[model samples]
Target chain A: MKARAFSYFRAATIEQALDAHALVGDDARFIAGGQSLVPALSLRLQAPRLLIDITHIGELRGVRREGGFLRIGALTRHCEMLSEPLIAEFAPLLQAAAPFVAHPAIRNRGTFGGSVALADPASEFPAMTLALDAEIEIAGPSGSRRIKADDFFIDLFETALQPGELITAIYVPLFKADQRFAFDEMARRRGDYALVGCGMLATCAGDRINDIRISFFSVGNTPTRVKGAEATLIGSSLNSERIAAAQAALEGDLAPPENDEVPPAMRLHLARVLLGRLLGRLGESA
Target chain B: MSGFDENLLDEADETVRVRFVVNGRKVACEVAPRETLVDCLRNELELTGTHAGCEMGACGACLVQLDGRAVHSCLMYAVQADGARIDTIDGLSESGVIADLQAEFHRRNALQCGFCTPGMLVNANELLSQVAEPSREEIRDALSGNYCRCTGYEAIVDAIDAVAKARNEGGSAT
Candidate 1:
């Protein structure tokens, strides 16, 4: 595993990190926990000339509740999210799905900004981001800007972020008491990446599904929210019929972008199973 | 791997000086930009007890103590450990519970070639340190990432259970 030689810059704060990034431009990369980046470097998959280590940035490591929204810092590790009380109450979808991330050790190091910025279709966080309508807060030279969850993801392994921009925090809305949430994923192993996953946030008025948001992953280039399914369920009573219709809509919308990980048929089949089980749970909760 | 971070991983080799307390001594060393902590420990520092089976993060063979918490050294860059504390298997080799774990593993024939014993011991010790009365399922889940092809996991689980039981019964603290 031979990688090209490069220099390491330890940035202790976001200001320091941004300064380093602005100077180095495309030559430099910002490393948070190095959970994913280090492995890629070892495999010779990527070779940048400079590295800006963001692990020591104190401001980027926290989870706090501000009024009606929970602000999760960019460097908040997955394990940290599991223990955060605010996430448990407001964004339980993230809490419930976090255990299914890789393994305990990996989750202890993998960061919130790292996963969302990388925008891996199979990652559990991206789907959760959409389901909760989370706002992605990023830092650039001019300062910070917030992006809507639907607009944050652009393409495969690509985001709307500019080269020098850095994600500093994520803000997810607190659900009303009437809302019910469920997250599910299918992986070959206990700690492996999901083959296909779904995060559902549905509000029930009586037995009718008033508001529904279903984010589907591993079935597209970027994990996407299936609005058709949401529309099909909205105002409809929770039952096998609505769920079946939603599943059908999601299955028809499935497009995995043609990868070697799984054939198209397998991807669609896994998406169906996962979404089916997730809606089933919603049925029980509703 | 779309989740792979290009900035940290793809960067070039920079020999950065870092100081850390390993085992019990403070040491200074120069590490390349992309050099992993596991490679630095095994190759540079000669901490052979902290083994490296899979260079990737899948296998927990390169587990080590970072400020009292067990972490996968492979996933961390050497420069990231500046001023940090590391406790390797060598540090715990002489401890009673660790020795007992080694002995029980031997008694149960948990290893065929003994390649994964050090890592499994570290992971098991870390788990038992936190969750003293971990259920069998918990033990299994904790050790899932640390793989062993030679011996079945039954003996390994038995060794861990016996050690836990002994410690609970207050017999010799072994």
Candidate 2:
């Protein structure tokens, strides 16, 4: 069904968008591509009084390599993340996970920051951003500031982004050449949201893992990075027994929500087993 | 009366101007705020070639090319169509490969009630453009977004396979 009546504001620049957001307060929302927001509107889940369309803001639409990090525009589409050359080089886990975000139609319109800012507990990018230790670049009336991905997610479907703040770009640190990554998710159908998902980014040299980051979604209040499991597994030579222990640790670490959509216990079990398989696959690929 | 009663926006006396290029023609007019692209194409434009089944995104009978990519039109707002170029089933009728798919659909009886034929043709045309020789699995995956409740999916696969074989063998199914 159609969404309720709301005023639409088309912003030609970032300043204009932020000002409108501030003036409108929480009643206003910044629309990048409207892939997620429109669905929420269609379902009447979100009923904002105004929609500030920032699609024409050229500042929010490029992926570039900076001195020490890869600066990706917030409005970059999901498919662009999948195939971008630099993303393939630096954020291989994001590249591996991109194809699983909705279907091609949604991928063609859904923005990276839109998903990350929405902070859906079951989304793909939040967990990946956390594992990669991404720094979110925000712009608001007070000017610019950076927030760590760890501090960005407040809770389920909640983020620390204030009403007037716009996530301009995401700064991803470099991944050493020896790094290997893998992402795995189980969905009932091709375009269905994940029942349980895992992303593994690990670096190895001479059979010893120097860096290991594991993250899971749909098994917690937010897209949670498995800190406990990583604490135990990182800097160790991951083997069959070690990997199995890590899997059990991850299962105990997650606390997924129970809903009509999924049972919490099933999601926990799936996340544990999938994390194990995904991390094991990364170890092999390395 | 029945349509209005079912419409949640029946009480809102509002309309938005929608302008877009459809099948090489510029159509511009005011539309009910709640109107969908599928309704605009099928009802307003009288391009009934883009069918609306399921009203939700599940069935791809409303599939159309929005800015060169396939999308379920029923899921899109009509106002979003402003300034965008769209290709409905009618536009694809003249597409060289679509005619081939239609002929194959006919030859293999890929359609029964003909409700899902428009979407099937649109999706199949996209696949044929990308992979002129797609395997059965690839063909299935390409049209995975579109749902067809008839022909048991076999005849459609057979039809696509025949077209692929013809293209590979340096023959024209058209």
Candidate 3:
């Protein structure tokens, strides 16, 4: 299926993109890499009257370090997450999850910010953001403001972004020496959406866990932070007993919706299995 | 706003003029805002090698090189590709850039129906350019998007593996 006919506007600057989107309001959408939006358009799931081509905007490009955080521009492609040295050194979790985002062709065109903005519950980067405790930078008609990743994702395919606002960049706190990251997803195929995916960043002190953030996707409406499980591992060693406790805690943290293919019980079982595997890996790294 | 801004298409405009380099040739044409690059390349530009399989990003059948990177041409509007350089399977084959891989594929009988050959070739070329010697697993991983109903993909992987070995050993694939 082809997309509905819509006016295309190539914005040279961030201001132009916001202005163009403002002109049409809800009828317009800012297109970054068009990986997801284009598919939605073709499927007629979304048909905006105007497509603000934000790819040409210079302000939304590049990845750089600022103080203690790595500022990754919204236009950073998924492929860059794997190849960019700054991201590899500063935010290795994203690099670990990049290959599972999609295939090479899709990764070549998909943007990190676009994926987060789309807030697909089955996506990797959005969940990783929660684990990394990243900040989402937004440019709106009034002014620019940053939103924490936890507050940015509201629901499935819904974000905190208001009408006519554009995501400018994502800021992740730099990875430190004490941090250990692990990411894995179970999927029927290599590039297909995960049956249940997880990414975690653990801060350890010697053999004990200091702090950890565990985020799971495809388990709920939004990328969920399993506080119950995190609490189970805090100040404890990632041994089999602790890992089992964390896995059991997932029963309260996650409530997989009933679906035709995978029942809720089966999904929760997979999440437990995945959590145990990730925690085991994190323990080895520590 | 500058006078150049006046050239921008309005919301009411049904067609927009776009120009891009295809296979090293500068080509300009008028296209509807909804017209995808795959459609434009096949219909207007007459580059039939770039097939439109799913018309969505799922099928790699419509893969093309936009600015030297493999992407789904069906996923992008032609207007968005204005001023960008595009390389289609027709262009890549004519240029002999992936001739060795093509020869190896032919030798292995990698393709039967051949609907997925162009995309596989384009994607394989991309993988080989990036990784000189990719493991069979890597090759399979790279070709995950390029689905083939026939040949069971074993031959396709074998063909790519052979090409990578020949190229790495500093020998001709033929």
| C-alpha lDDT values of all predictions | 0.82, 0.79, 0.92
| Per-residue lDDT of model 2, residues A68-182, tens digit only | 8889999999979867899988878788888778766567677998889888877888888988888999998899999988899888778888768999999988777787778
lDDT of 2 by residue, B65-88 (tens): 888777778766677667899998
How high is the lDDT of residue A164 in model 3? 85
In model 1, which residue pairs have backbone atoms overlapping below 3 Å? A5-B12, A5-B13, A6-B12, A6-B13, A6-B14, A29-B7, A46-B10, A47-B10, A48-B10, A48-B11
Better of 1 and 3 by TM-score: 3
Candidate 3 per-residue lDDT, tens place, B1-174, comes to: 221142343643578899999999999999998899999999999999999998878879999999999999998999999999999999999999899999988999999899999999999999999999999999999999988989899999999999999999999777
Candidate 2: which pairs clash?
none
Worst-scoring 10-residue span by lDDT in model 3 chain A: A16-25
Give per-residue lDDT, candidate 2, residue A194.
86
Off by over 4 Å in 3: B1-13
Q: What TM-score should be assigned to candidate 3?
A: 0.98
Best-to-worst order by lDDT is 3, 1, 2
Model 2 chain B poorest 10 in a row by lDDT: B1-10
Interface RMSDs of all predictions? 7.2, 9.1, 2.9
TM-score, second chain, candidate 3:
0.93
lDDT string, candidate 1, A1-286, tens digits: 7456777777777888888778778877888877788788778788778778888888897888887899999998898778888888888989988988777777778898999988988888987899999999999999989999899999889998899889999999987889999998888877777788889898888788889888988777888898888888999988888878877887667776666878888888778778888888888885
